[model samples]
Target: MYMVLVRTRVLPGDLLHDSYTGIAPPNTYKLGNKLFSLKVGLVEIDGKDVKLIPLAGPYIPRVNDFVIGKIIDFDAFSWDVDINSIYTAHLPAQDVFGREFSSQTHSLTSQFKVGDMLAAKIIAFDRTKDPVLTVREHGLGKIVHGEPIKLSPSKIPRLIGKKGSMAKIIETKTKTKLIIGQNGIIVVQGPSEGIVLAARAIHLIEEKAHMPSLTNMINELLTKEV
Candidate 1:
């Protein structure tokens, strides 16, 4: 089935579609023969399947999910990280130093100081406790250089676009590299000119996520004279 695009931003209780158009997905309520949005998001009609794409929301961590986090604070055992979530995640010193970790012998400050940024994976998370992160895996570690920026967590999918098409477009046009975190943090590394353009393109995706022609709009901005 093909998809039909929508550009309208919606709020709670806004009319969505009719029952005959197929039932609206989650975050929507049915009123007699009509469906109304139950959250702040944008409407999408995929074939006969209508759903809402949220515009604003916090990142909810899941195990094995890669995230971009900033080192906020540190103790001898672990470091507190801001993963753009309500709960702060912790990266254990052991994860960095291996299982036989020594708080005294191995100084955490020497490895990762406060205000440092790192890309990590959510090794563990549950409602009972905050998430746990680890950077031992390949492609996960300290971000020594790059221009970091934030976007609405809900808009990350849009930023990446369908099957990473949008991200590829930005990278190809700007000659920049993007490291995206599911937590809404992005680090752009490349020429200063390319970084600036890439950043602008990212913000546009966040602002116009609800727009049907979002990809086209971003392309226009990326091609425009700086």
Candidate 2:
């Protein structure tokens, strides 16, 4: 029978498991009898499997990932958006307006022009093809106002904190509304001063995500700002 090993923290290139111990999962690869970590992350030993949870990495598009994008160009049926990824995302006109879209009569530019910002969902992506995006879902549409800030995609979870606790705290203390995209784009809306404060708080979170007592430190900083 297989046995579970104690949890351990590991860094990139660290030996995580051996062939006799467990099979590596995500962020780890096996070579010979040893499984090595591919990222700075936490390792979980579950029964006969070893899994790694990455703490840092660039944003990689995945299905259903909500993102904020800026319109860069448009063709007859689709618009290309910059979603802060290596691949540009395509938002089809039909996807934006549903199946009722009349391509023969409606002008795409009239509905969505260049430079428009939108909150969209990644519908599809692959290395061989450009990413696909859609704004048909609820609360996914044009972003008309607010200041946009960028942070490391890896730090998004930390900024959000556990169960949205840190995000709620930032919004409460700064009196702002935050719309965070998994791609590390955050739109801050509220009083101008509040927006600045919220942005500062988010930057602080991004800067110190790896440190211990981060949540408390952010809380204290917010208290001082408020």
Candidate 3:
């Protein structure tokens, strides 16, 4: 049986020890007679067996997830993107940033080339094709660039919070527009100092995503001066 040495405090990549078996999960292993498990994840280490914790900002893109990406290439039917996620998100030609594609040429690379950033949402992921993304709605499109920072994709949902509570708080406090990508990237614009402070605050929230009262904590932190 798995021994519960420390209740549930294990961090991602933490090794769990079995009392009788003396072995642990392959990704995780135990040291002989050691009371505590080693922290193998990027951030912290915990000895107890706990829920799987994402080590970084959002990485995987679920359907309907809002994301920010850079346009790598544009075609008459679609736009190739470099979203921070594991897959290359695609923007259909019909969903082009502004209007339906008027270009007769199949290749739209001339119109939109590399390094064009946009705020979009994941609509669907077709295993045959790439993940389909869109920026065809209001509140979506090129984010006004200011200071760019990278974050883990996994931590995004937490930073956003339920009904966008966490994000709203940060936006209100920092007075900056924060755009998050599924691939661990974020775009922040507004006052330079405020953006930096907001980035730090978001990182903190990502680290504590599993906490129950994180919103309250972040609200307090954002309210305080940088």
Runs off by more than 4 Å, candidate 3: 1-7, 10-53, 56-58, 75-77, 97-111, 208-226
**Residue-by-residue lDDT tens digits, candidate 2, 1-226:** 4546554677999976556344557788878877789998767776566767677788899999999999999988899999998889999999876788878877899878999999999989988999999888899999999999998887888888889999999999999999999998999989999998988888887777767688898789889978
Sorted by lDDT, highest first, which candidate order results?
1, 2, 3
List the pairs of residues colliding in candidate 2.
Answer: none
Per-residue lDDT of candidate 1, residues 134-159 (tens digit): 99989999999999989998888898
**Candidate 3 lDDT by residue in tens digits, 27-96:** 3444664423343332232444332344433265678877778888765577888887667887876666
**Candidate 2 regions with alpha-carbon error over 4 angstroms:** 1-9, 20-23, 42-51, 100-102
> Any idea what lDDT model 3 has?
0.67
Task: Judging by TM-score, tell me the better candidate of 2 and 3.
Answer: 2
Top candidate, metric TM-score: 2
- In terms of lDDT, model 2 sits at 0.85
Please give the RMSD of candidate 2 to the true structure. Answer: 2.6
Candidate 1 or 3, higher lDDT?
A: 1
Model 1: which residue pairs collide? none
Please provide TM-scores, in order, for all candidate models, with all chains considered together: 0.84, 0.88, 0.65
Worst 10 residues of 1 by lDDT: 15-24
How does residue 162 of candidate 2 score in lDDT?
88
